[model samples]
Target: MSIKIRGSNAYGHSGWFTVYCRICNRKLKIGTDLVYKCPKCEKKYNAYFCEADARGLKWKCPYCNTELVPVI
Candidate 1:
């Protein structure tokens, strides 16, 4: 047998986005992208996946018209 690498470096489900609604805090059943558009206001979001891994991207809440100021 040859001495070679025999492992995998593939991206699995746990390392990717869960694709859910931030406002509703529910997993989306239709969206299929890193960016999710709110059906109600057509607003896109990175989504708050969890407390340890928040994807709280700054963007305007089209529904509420609230400017999500960037935390710079």
Candidate 2:
């Protein structure tokens, strides 16, 4: 599954996506930050994680109990 962008309607920005780490509350920017995305829960939960947090969780989604995939 693809990472769904939430609240995309901002001033002058059309297709920009702002994602955050689920565990650290850190802002994750595409092309700069390595993010783990929950394939099963992204649309519903908007679950994204930093590399360390994702590894800490054993590459699993804590909410949906599904395997987390890295966003490349």
Candidate 3:
């Protein structure tokens, strides 16, 4: 499964992009707009802005030691 960003001219932005979780192969609802970064590996991820404070489940990328950021 893979997430794909879609649409055009969304919320004043030039493109209407949506977040899809590749593992789940589903389009994630945009409850909020925010981006996150992993402190360990310096990788970046996107999630709903409202979920920023939620404790993240332990997950890591196979190729890197950095914690995987959750996408809402």
Candidate 4:
């Protein structure tokens, strides 16, 4: 089984990316929507949250207990 990951430059594709809120599964748009990322463990956990979800989480990384940072 092979898992294909879609990411900016994931397959030599540039200038394209999509993010989603881990909590509610809402699609997040950069620049247009406020986003938060967990710096301490984002690489491993892939934690991304939209504004409302981030606030609901108290701006903390649920996995690592690290404070979340704004994407912008």
Residue 72, candidate 2: C-alpha displacement in angstroms: 2.4
TM-score of each: 0.26, 0.73, 0.35, 0.73
Query: Which candidate order results from sorting by TM-score in descending order?
Result: 4, 2, 3, 1
lDDT of each: 0.41, 0.83, 0.40, 0.82
Cα lDDT of model 2 by residue, 1-72, tens digit = 976545656454534656888888988876677889999888887889999999999998999888999787
Q: In model 1, state the lDDT of residue 20.
A: 55
Whole-model lDDT, model 2: 0.83
In model 2, what lDDT does residue 46 have? Answer: 85
- Cα lDDT tens digits, model 3, 1-72, are 976545553344523445544333344444455433344433254322223222332354433445556443
lDDT measured at residue 63 in model 1 versus the true structure, 0 to 100: 52
The better-scoring model by lDDT among 1 and 4 is 4
The predictions' CA RMSDs to the true structure, in order, are 10.8, 8.5, 10.4, 7.5
Model 1 root-mean-square deviation: 10.8
Off by over 4 Å in 3: 1-7, 10-15, 32-57, 70-72
Residue 8 of model 3: what lDDT?
55
